[model samples]
Target chain A: MTRQELFEQIKIKQSFLCVGLDTDLNKIPSHLQKVADPIFEFNKQIIDQTADFAVAYKPNIAFYEALGPKGWESLQKTLDYIPKNIFSIADAKRGDIGNTSGLYAKAFFETMDFDSITVAPYMGIDSVSPFLSYENKWVILLALTSNEGSLDFQFSELKNGKPVYQEVLEKSSKWGNPDNMMYVVGATRGEKIGEVRKIVPEHFFLVPGVGAQGGSLEEVAKYGMNSRCGLLVNSSRGIIYAGKGTDFGTEARKEAKKLQGEMEVLLNQYCY
Target chain B: MTRQELFEQIKIKQSFLCVGLDTDLNKIPSHLQKVADPIFEFNKQIIDQTADFAVAYKPNIAFYEALGPKGWESLQKTLDYIPKNIFSIADAKRGDIGNTSGLYAKAFFETMDFDSITVAPYMGIDSVSPFLSYENKWVILLALTSNEGSLDFQFSELKNGKPVYQEVLEKSSKWGNPDNMMYVVGATRGEKIGEVRKIVPEHFFLVPGVGAQGGSLEEVAKYGMNSRCGLLVNSSRGIIYAGKGTDFGTEARKEAKKLQGEMEVLLNQYCY
Candidate 1:
């Protein structure tokens, strides 16, 4: 899906929240464990309960992958369960050779039906171009991440006088336009989001690390929000596994509503 | 698996070849298509025929993930089909937040049961350290990729007067010792392999871009080979889908043998 369509969905739903489906079998309540696919069951409930409050569902590939074959089946089911208007992301973080990446594009876009897939840009353009080739598909490339270790290489000053992450943002921008591409600038790096904004103000930013990761949503919105409300703030543990009991779905909805409410305030402040 | 164990496997097999199980459904013969899972079937046969000759089997995750839930199922079966002694890699190129990355560690190492997995170091230490937490498991960080676009950022000079690829190799080396870490230095970048070896002489290197990618194995071996035969030369399409007819397995085996034969000679010259 194009970025504009995603923006419209967010506006219509009055939410910019992307509920992360990092569902873990071990973390789910034991009551649901008896279900054939507990991961899918959990995802289904989460989607059903929180669909109205969330504009996107980001299913982390690793969680489903941990269950082996059964986990994958659950992931597919979860993707199918998500509403058509909501953006679905296979947070796979995949990138490889050109031919191999093309096959990956087919896997996520053509076969399983996800609107977007997160890609690691370390392999350079060839690995990312394959994903970009799909019409209307999005490539969320890693820029400045939230982790403390991000200071190691990403912030390292390059010979060209720019930091490594900035260089990646500048170079990768040429591969695809803002409509087909996005950058993952972690919300935890609130101070630096302004620096990131200067690089690509038009592209949407998939901002994670809010809530449970200690990133302030207020700070991220203040510094990172553009005219288009260019942010998809994700909160996995904070939203999905909020209550952890029989009323988990209700609690999830409440948590999503809280985030959406905050997002609405941000959107209004940014004149969206 | 530990680097010592991987080296022993190479010596026992008298080859440093790592057959890339990049099984593409479209590339497999029609006869295999009738199987329950064509990708898994092809991988099983390839593993069986080449297990005695190859030191490792690198399954690029894009290939498996492209098939969706079924592809992941095939990946699990292929992992099971590989001999216990040979090194197995889930080339997923994953790197994310610390907590999420910990789950990724569990997915590949604890759940899916791979000896190693490819990672993109662009996210820096937090993105990579979670993978290193797994004892004896390897994190094959992308160093120098073999693609035209690799020149975009990887070769851009860093403020430390080193290229970004060199900076990644140098910094990431501090996170894990050579025994638990490796870097992917593309085989096509033979000239720079010598430079990479200078920085990461102890860690093993997973070199792709051989065979179909037009990378010279001899040049790679000459410059990149370390004292322990520290190179996992991967040939994906050129070896796995050598022929498209019913004798695909036989053809695959023949193609793998040709690479192994060359690897055997390289091993002798370097190790002895």
Candidate 2:
């Protein structure tokens, strides 16, 4: 999807919420395991319930890959089930050489048909450029991640006082504009969100680490928001696994609705 | 496979050669496409031919993943076919949060039964720790990549004058001991291999860009080699697609044998 289209969706829904389908068979309700493909079934219900509130759905590829061929089948099913109007992201942190990355671009963009795929920037331009080849498709590069490991190298000060991620932001911005590129800035680094905004004010930021990871949504909106509401705050476990019982779908909707309601206010205050 | 076992395999084979199974449908011979599963069939033939000369088989995961479900099935078959003595690497540069990285660890190590999976170090400790959780399995973190993009952020000088890749080597060494951890130092960065050796001398280095990518095996062996012949120099397109005609297998084996012959000399000169 185009940046304008994505921004439009955020405006129309009044929520830049992206529900992460980190669907694990063991975590889903045990009753659903009786089905041939429980992960898909669980995701279908979760997507169905949360679709209205979420402007996007990101299927964490690791969850699907763990199950092998069956997992991939479930992933394809989940991708197909997501509403076309809503943006879909293959949260597959994939990057390789130019040729190999092109194949990945094809896997997520052409074959699987995700609007975006998360890419790691460690390999640099060639590894990421292939994903940017597609029109309207997005490459959500890992800028400042939420994990504890983020401190090990991400925050390393370069020779010019630029943090490694800032260097990543600066170098990568030349490869693609805000239209086709987004950065994954962890909401756990809430205070630093402003730092990221200062670098790429126009580009969208896919902010993970909200409820379960202890990132405050209000802080993210306050610091990260732009004129186009340039933020996609993702809540995976917090929303999908809101309840383990049969009413899990309803419970998930409740959580998503709660976030959406807050996002609606933020959208009105910032973008709208 | 255990570190000792890997060393033993290298000694027995007289080569630390790793054949990269970057199988693509478009790249393989047309005659093979007539088969039910050309990618697997191609891999099976390559493995059968080069199994004696090579100590490891590294399947570049993106190639298979691009084909969707059928590609995954082909990958499973290929994995099952590889001899137990030969180390298997899923070149799936994957990394995420702790939980998600755990799932990825399961995907490559448990479900797929790969001995190692290439990991991107942008996320830090939690993203890498899960891969280290498995006994005997390896996490070959991206240290200094072979591609031109490696110059982008990997070579950034930190506050202490340590290059970014050096920092990656220093910090990640704590996550996994030499037994379970490895670093991918691209063959293209042949001169820098000695610098990497100084940092983590005992750990194995999965060196790519050897043949097709213009990396000198002699330079890699000279600088990167350790007491255990700690290098799995990979040659993908050069060996696998050596011949597109009917004699593809024979040509591939010829290339493998040639590399193996050179590796044998290096082993004798260095370790023995």
Candidate 3:
């Protein structure tokens, strides 16, 4: 989807939320395990319950991959089931040399048809350029990730006195404009979000550390929000694993609704 | 497989050559396309013809994944068909948060039963620690890659006056001993391989870019070889796409034999 198109979805839904389907079979309700495709069934219900509050659904590819080919079948089904208006993200975190990266672009963009795939920037421009070549498909490059490991390499000081992550933002942001690219800026450090925003002021930031990871929604909005409501705050574990019972979808919806509520208030106030 | 087991295979085969199974359906011979599982059939024939010359087979995951679940099924078949003595590598280049990285480790290690998986180091310690926890399995972290994009960040000068890739070598080498960890030091720059070897003298280095990407095998052996033959030089297109006819496997075997022949001499000389 184009940047304008994605912003329109945010405007129409009054939510910039991207529900993460990091669905693990071990974590889902036991009763659903007997189903033909439990992972798909779980994701279908999650989308059904949370679709109203979310503009996108981010499926971390590792979850389904753990189950092998059968898992990929379920993932394809889940992608097919999502509403057309809602953007889909394959959080695959894939990057390689140019030719191999092209095949990955084909995998996510042509074969399974995701709107975007998260890319690791370690391989440099060739690894990223293949994904960016596709029109309307986004390359969400890993900048400052939400995990504790982000501090290890992302913060390494360059000779110019900027951290490695900032250098990633500066160089990679030029590879594609705001329309075809986005950055995964962790929400854990609100000040860091502001710092990243200063680097790529117009690009959409997929902030992933909001609910379960102890990142505050208020602070993310305060630091990161732009005129386009340029943020997709994700809450995976807290919402998807909200209730372990049969009515888990209801509980998941409740959690998503709460986040949507907070986002609504932020969109009105902080998003000038 | 343990480090000793891999080294023993290298000695037994008289080669440290790693055959990269970057099997693309589009690139395979026309005769194989009509088979029930063409990808697996092609791989089976290739393994049969070249197993004697290659000690390790590294399948680049993106090629199979581009074809979707059917691709993965073909991959499983290919993995199953390989000889037990040979080392198997899923060149998946995968890494995420701690929990998600654990799932990836499970996918490549337990679920699929790969001996090792190439992991990107951009996410750092926690992203790598999960893979290191697995006994006998290896995490070949990307240090300096062969592509032009390697220049983007891997060469960034850090506060300590060393390049980022060197820092990756220094910090991550301690994460796991030679038993479970290896670094992907590209053969494109022989001096860089020597630089990487200086930091992690004992850990194995999975060096790509030998033939097809224009890295000299002699230079790689000269710079990267350690006392234990700590190198797995990979060549995908040079060996796999060497022939495009019905006799492709025979042609591939000839290419593998040529590399193995060179490696035999190198092993006898430099690997003291």
Model 3 global lDDT (CA atoms, 0 to 1): 0.93
True contacts kept of each: 0.82, 0.89, 0.86
Rate residue A130 of model 2 by lDDT. 94
- List TM-scores of chain B, every candidate: 0.97, 0.99, 0.99
Residue B220's lDDT in candidate 3: 96
lDDT at residue B68 of model 2 (Cα atoms)? 95
Q: What lDDT is reached at residue B271 by model 2?
A: 80
Off-target runs (Cα >4 Å) in candidate 3 are none
Q: Model 3, range B1-272, lDDT digits (tens) per residue?
A: 98889999999999999999999998999998898999999999989989999999999999999999999999999999889899999999999999999999999988898999999999989999999998889999999998999999999999889899988888888888989999888888888888888888999989999998999999999998999999999989899889999989999999999999999999999985
Q: A153-225 in candidate 3: lDDT tens per residue?
A: 9999999999999999999998999998899999889988998988898999999988889999999999999
Lowest summed lDDT across 10 adjacent residues in model 1 chain B is found at B62-71
Deviation in Å, model 1, residue A257 alpha carbon: 1.8
What TM value does model 1 have? 0.95
Candidate 3: give the clashing pairs.
none
Q: Which model is ahead, 1 or 2, in terms of lDDT?
A: 2
